[model samples]
Target: MTSSPSQRLAWPDVAKGISILGVVLLHITLTVPESKDTWLAAFNVWLDPLRLPLFFLVSGFFAQKVFRFSFAELFTRRLWYFLVPYVVWMLVEQQTKRVEYHWVFGDPVFDFSQMTASLLVGHSMAWFLHSLILFNLFLWCVRKLPGWAALALSFSPILFIAWQAQFTSIAKAIMFLPVFVAAACFRDAISAFASAIEAPFKGEWDYRSFWAYSGMVGAYAIGFFIRRTWDSYAGAVEVTWLLPGTEALVRDDVHILVRMVEQFFEVPVGIAVAVAVSYIPVLSTGLRFIGSHTLPIYLGHPIGLTVLYGYPMALNPREVSLAGQWPLENTWFWLSMCFVYCAIASLVLWALGKVPVVGWTLKPPPIGASRRTTEPPSAGLSLSQKLTETRNATTRK
Candidate 1:
């Protein structure tokens, strides 16, 4: 079926911006010294819960389209897109001690293998790249298949929870498939939801606005909650929750249901807030700016945040001790500043993409080469006659 630009879904960048911001918050939570304080600690705990899931969901939402490419084309294009940069950065990362290198065989090897694996299976922030690659592959295989088939394939997450207890690698791979599939299978519903909000509903209660706001708010609430809870529970809850066996699975299933319920309420709350903010001309315009640049923001934010978090303390001798200083000192201020900073960085990255060398990296490659055509001979002849004439002509030449 033909899809509109709206159906194409413009909010990926917005979601990407949110995802990158979540990554930043995760890093900040882990690294920030002041987090020892009660309130900040509590806040970070909450953020961790939804931070990574939010990123994975956004990825799943977009993976359906990637299912269209041929395997060779998809692998060659995407593999190199991330691989080239990832390798380059990991090498550079070694210079700064940002990466962990390992001994493989008798030689000390740069662990490009882990980096590569991260691009395929969800591996922390690295999983974003990994899940993306797999999701694209998985979606391509099932895109033309029936919706029910696709969803059945997507529901593999249940198995993932079971497997994660014994086989982390297998579990992660299986778990991610469902999320990626969910985005594709639910594409129609999500689009319908978006459209419903674009129009006005009776009274002030617009369904679209509600979802958008809910997703936004829920993103934050979940992010804050997970981080706080993990620390408090010593990260045991997540492990217990993912463990195998019927009893653990049943118990975790109940927790998952409860969390989903809370998320249902929280996401709408967040989305409602987003809707209200969107109605305000200034905030709306600002979100649009952030949303527009979100893709670049996603790719580039790692470098920028690395600078903000990694360098200041490393270079300045005393800054490491005072590194406890928060970027904006409060959620509102920090988030707003992060939004602006990422937006500007995205714009700059966008502009840089216009350059021949950089542009190639930012966009996906074309699917196929242009077909060439040659005109048939102006005059027609019988097969035997034509063969004889061609032979005679060749002899003469």
Candidate 2:
């Protein structure tokens, strides 16, 4: 029996859902004072390799379609999809920070200088949006070049930055661009592999399923060990065998070099885990819902965490620290806080997306300026409806 189109799409959505959840968990683990040094923090570290890289890889998986659009269409879509949100959210984040600063310090001072700097360089968490816009433009500009040459050109800066340990948002974008481009280039191969993995499960456990399952476990295990070692070393080590006279180089430089090497292995492991996890229907279904609205969840989760934790910390850092130290002593409590923040953020965004004008903050605007129809916004669609529409569109194409 053949798998339905919806079934085929589920894994990618699941993968994305997992990635976004990891991102949210990572932020929570890092942001909450209580969670520091707990097992939750260690879990977050383990998840670090899978989080953003998987997100970018998935984005890349869809890039082939975007690459086909005309310049006008591309501009319109990207503007609505990335740039507009980036600008709007950056302003919102900065304004929130300004207010937070004042409330915490008992001084109503707006730091124009810092805001101006953020504008020039991408704002805090909003950098991902800024980077996405730039990556699209960069890829388009080099579209005429031979594929290998284009990839090489795109990768050069990333290598330089990685070696130097200079990790600005722009550098991070450059680092991840190759993954995105590779996905666009090899979408068919990936799709086919996913299909092969799913084929056996449609009937009964077979050799293919066994190998697929084993591969998934093996990849995840390798990734886990890699992350553990990377953390153990703090990305700094002497490699006299790898490079002669490298002892002269500073620990930071060696750390960056080790990180660069670790990523080369880690990203593929993330992709493998994503593909492997997709075969499980129940897990996929739950994650698919979260994956579908990742944009809003991504933008809103930090705000939710900030509101929950940041205010109290700002008001009385020492008091908040002492209070957090106790509850966080329980590992389960720390883990639950991560889930709670993510759930709260998702709910808040979902609620905001239901409103008319306010929904624009969470969902992409309609493609053209003219709103000729009284139809509801796309955000209102159920998961099944969205998946069906996607399948129909893929079939039509």
User: Where is the poorest 10-residue window by lDDT in model 1?
Assistant: 98-107
- List the candidate 2 regions with Cα displacement exceeding 4 Å: 1-8, 105-109, 159-167, 203-257, 316-338, 367-397
| Per-residue alpha-carbon lDDT of candidate 1 for residues 243-304, written as tens digits (9 for 90 to 100) | 44543554334344344434433432332333344455665565546655544655555554
Tell me the whole-model lDDT of each prediction, alpha carbons only.
0.50, 0.66
Could you give candidate 2's per-residue lDDT for residues 243-288 as a string of tens digits? 3323355555444444444554566556556656766668766788
Q: 222, model 1: CA deviation in Å?
A: 13
Report the number of the highest-lDDT candidate: 2
- CA lDDT for candidate 2: 0.66
For each candidate in turn, give its C-alpha RMSD to the true structure in angstroms: 11.8, 7.0
Off by over 4 Å in 1: 1-13, 36-59, 62-124, 157-177, 197-277, 315-352, 364-397
Top candidate by TM-score: 2
lDDT of 1 at 393: 78
In model 1, state the lDDT of residue 111: 52
